[model samples]
Target: MTSTESSSRPYGAFPVRIGFQVQPQHAEYGQIRRAVAAAEEAGVDIVFNWDHFYPLSGEPEGLHFECWTMLGAWAEATERVEIGALVSCNSYRNPELLADMARTVDHISNGRLILGIGSGWFEKDYQEYGYEFGTAGGRLDILAEALPRIEQRLSKLNPQPTRNIPVLIGGGGEKKTLKLVAKHATIWHGFGDAETVAHKHAVLDQHCADVGRDPGEIERSVAVSDSPEKVGQGLLDVGTRLFTVSASGPDYDLGLLREWISWRDEQNK
Candidate 1:
C-alpha cells in the first residue's frame, strides 16, 4: 500500500463527515419530509435520497417518490445540510438537462448540493419507464460519455451554480467507474467491509496515478452500518472520511444517525 493509504496520516487531518440517505420509499411524502428534518437536526453533513421510480425493498407497490423533484423540495425546505440523490441514474435523462436541474437546485439551496450519480442498475426502472435496459458495460459507457457533457452544461448555465457543486460518483467498478472517478469526481461514494474498502482504495489510487491526479484530491465516502463502535473505526483507518448511514421510511428510525453524529463529534475532538 502507498503511504497515502497508511494509517500514520493524522486523524485530525482526516476529519470525519457523516451523511444520511433517507430512502424515498415505503412512506408518505410528509413522513420523508419529517425524516429529513430529523436527520438535519441530528447533525449530519449531507442528506441524500435514491433515484428510482419503484420501491427498492418491501412492497414493490409501496409509496415512493421521484428523485429530482423531491430534491427540489428539499432544496426549498432545508437550510443547512447539503442535499442530493445518493445517486441519480445517468441513463434516466439527458446529461445537459440533468446539469441544469442540478444548477437550479444548487441555487435553491444557496450552494448546498452534491451531485451524486451512478451509471444505473435496476432493469425494472428502465423497462417500466420506457428506457433501454442494456448491458452493464453499455450503461457505464453511457455514463463515461455523459459526465463531460454534464460538466460542459454546468459551465454554460446562465445563473451558474452557487458553488462548483461538488460531483460525487458512486460505484465500485474498478475499471471504468474508478477511472471516471479519478478523472471527474470530487467525491467517490463506495461500499464494502474494511478489507474491501482498502482494496478498492488501492485500485482507485492506481487509477489516479494512471491519470496523473492525486488520489487525495478526491474524498473517500462509504455507506456504513449504524454501529460505529463495531465497524466504523476499521473503515476510518482505511481512509474513508465520510460515513453515510441510510434510513428508510415510514418511521425512519434515526437512532443510528444519532450514534454516528455522536461518534463523529468524539472522533473530531
Candidate 2:
C-alpha cells in the first residue's frame, strides 16, 4: 500500500492516536502513577505498560514490575486514557483466561481497555516463570492457533466485554504475523522505518485481500523515536494513525509524550 492509501482525505477524519509505553522496568510505582497522570492530563489517547518481568534495556537486573498487576492499578488510577500492555505475551497466560482478565479490566476501566498482544519473544520471561521457552516459529505457531480461540472465548464469556475490546497485535513478520493481523487484529503494531513499515503494510493489504477482509479495518500503529517531525508525516501518509513512544522508568520522561500529544491534537484539528 502506498502512503496515500491510509489518508483521511479519502476516509473523512482519522483521529490520531498517541500512545505512551510507560516502561515498568526501572521506575517506581508512584513515579509511574504520576507519569500516567501527567500523560492523561496532557491528553494522550493511550497509556501503555509493557508485559515483562525484567528490563528489556539498560541494566537487566534493574528495578522491574509485573504486567497485569500494574495494569490493574492503572485501571483504577487513570480516568480517561485507554490502558493495556504495549503487547501482552500470549504464552504467559491461557487464551481463555487472558480473555477473562481483559474483560474484567475492561469493566474496571469503564470500557477503556485495549487488549494489546503478541507472540511471546523474550526467552527470560518464559524460563524464569517456568514456561518452556520454545523456538520463535513454535511460539508464533502457538499465537496463530490461540488467537481465534481467544476470540471465541470472548464471545462465550458471561456478561462479555464492556465494549468490543480492541485487539492490538505487534510484530512485522510478513508471512504468518501479517496474515494473523489481517485475520484477527483490530490494530497492527509494526516496527521499522517508514519505507519498511509501508512495505509491510502492503504485504498486510495483500493478506487482507486474500482473507476477504478490508485492509483499512486494521489500524496501523508504530513505535516512533522521540523525534516526531523526522518521521511523523511519512508514517501518517502510510496509514499509521497510531504512534507510540516508549520511555523507561526511574525517570519517566513526560516531555516527549507531551510533544506527541500536542502533535496529535494539531493533526486532528
Candidate 3:
C-alpha cells in the first residue's frame, strides 16, 4: 500500500465495509426481522435500525418500533453482522441508562455492537413523547455532556463491554458534532456529495489537530442510497471506508445493499 493508502484504512487493517439501515416503519415486525436476517445473509457488515418513536417518512401515523428493544431482538436473531441504532437520540433516554442498554446488547451479541448516537431531532417525536424539544444547540450541548457519562457508565458496568464497544457518532455539524467526533468517536457518520464530504473531513481534521488527536484515528463514513459507482470511489479517495445505505420497510429491499457489498468486495480486492 502507498502512504496515502496506509493512512486511509479506517480501522487500521480492516477493509472497506458496507452497512444497511433497515428503517423500522410502515411494516410488520416480522418483515423487519426478516430484513435483518436477509441483510446479514447477504453479507452486510453492519445492520442498523433508526432510533425513533414514529416513522421518519411516508405516513405520519404508520407503524414504527422502538430502537433499543428491536436491537435486543436482533442480538439473538443475527449471528454475524454488528447491530445498533443508526443514531440513538441522547435526549430520549438517560445517558447512563443508554450505556447500560448498549452493554447488555453487546453481551447478548457476544460483542457485535456499535453504539451509534447523536443529538435529538424531529420535533414531533419530542412533542408527542413530552421530551423537551430544545433548540439544536441546546441538544448538542446535552450530547456533549452525555457522551462521557455514557463512556464512564460503560466502564463501571458489570463485566464491562465485550470489546470496548466502538462508538459511531452520526451527524455533519462542522462545529460541535465534528469536535465531538474528534474527541470520542471511533467512527463518524456523515452525508453529502464528495466535495461536501471532503470539506467536512478537512474541518474534522482541524478539530483533531486542535485536540492533539491523530486525524487518522477516526474512521470516515458516509450514507448513500444510490449510484455507489459514482460516489463511492470519490468518497474512498478522500478516506471514507464505510458506506451505509438506507432502506425503508414494507419491503426492505436488499438489492442496493447487495450491489454495495459487491462493490466493496471489488474495491478491497
Query: lDDT: which candidate is best?
Result: 1
User: What is candidate 3's lDDT per residue for 1-269, written digit by digit as tens?
Assistant: 34376455444344689999999999999999999999999899999999898898999989998999999999999999999888999999999999999999999999999999999899999999999997999999999999999999999999888898999999999999999999999889999887788788889989998999987778788999776877777777777889999888799888888999999999888
Q: lDDT scores for all predictions?
A: 0.91, 0.87, 0.90
Q: Assess the local accuracy of residue 231 in candidate 1 as a C-alpha lDDT between 0 and 100.
A: 83
Rate residue 83 of model 2 by lDDT.
95
Task: Give residue 26's error in model 3 in angstroms.
Answer: 0.3
What candidate 2 gets wrong by more than 4 Å, as runs, is 1-13
- In model 2, where is the ten-residue run with the lowest total lDDT? 4-13
lDDT of 3 at 17: 92
True-structure lDDT of candidate 1: 0.91
User: Worst ten-residue run, lDDT, model 1?
Assistant: 3-12
| Per-model TM against the reference | 0.96, 0.95, 0.95
lDDT of 2: 0.87
Evaluate residue 205 in candidate 2 and report its C-alpha lDDT on the 0 to 100 scale.
87
Off by over 4 Å in 1: 1-14
| Pairs of residues at least 3 apart in sequence or in different chains that clash in candidate 3 | none
**Per-residue lDDT of candidate 1, residues 1-269 (tens digit):** 34355556432255789999999999999999999998898789999999999999999989999999999999999999999999999999999999999999999999999999999999889999999989999999999999999999999999888898899999999989999999999889999998998888889889988999888778889998749999888888888899999978898999989999999999888
Off by over 4 Å in 3: 1-14
The sequence of per-residue lDDT tens digits that candidate 2 reaches over residues 1-269 is 34455554321145789999989877778988888898888888899998889999999888898999888888999899999998899999999999999998998999999999999789888888899887888889999989998999999988889889999999998998999999998889989888898898889989998999887788888998857787888888877788998888788888887788888888888
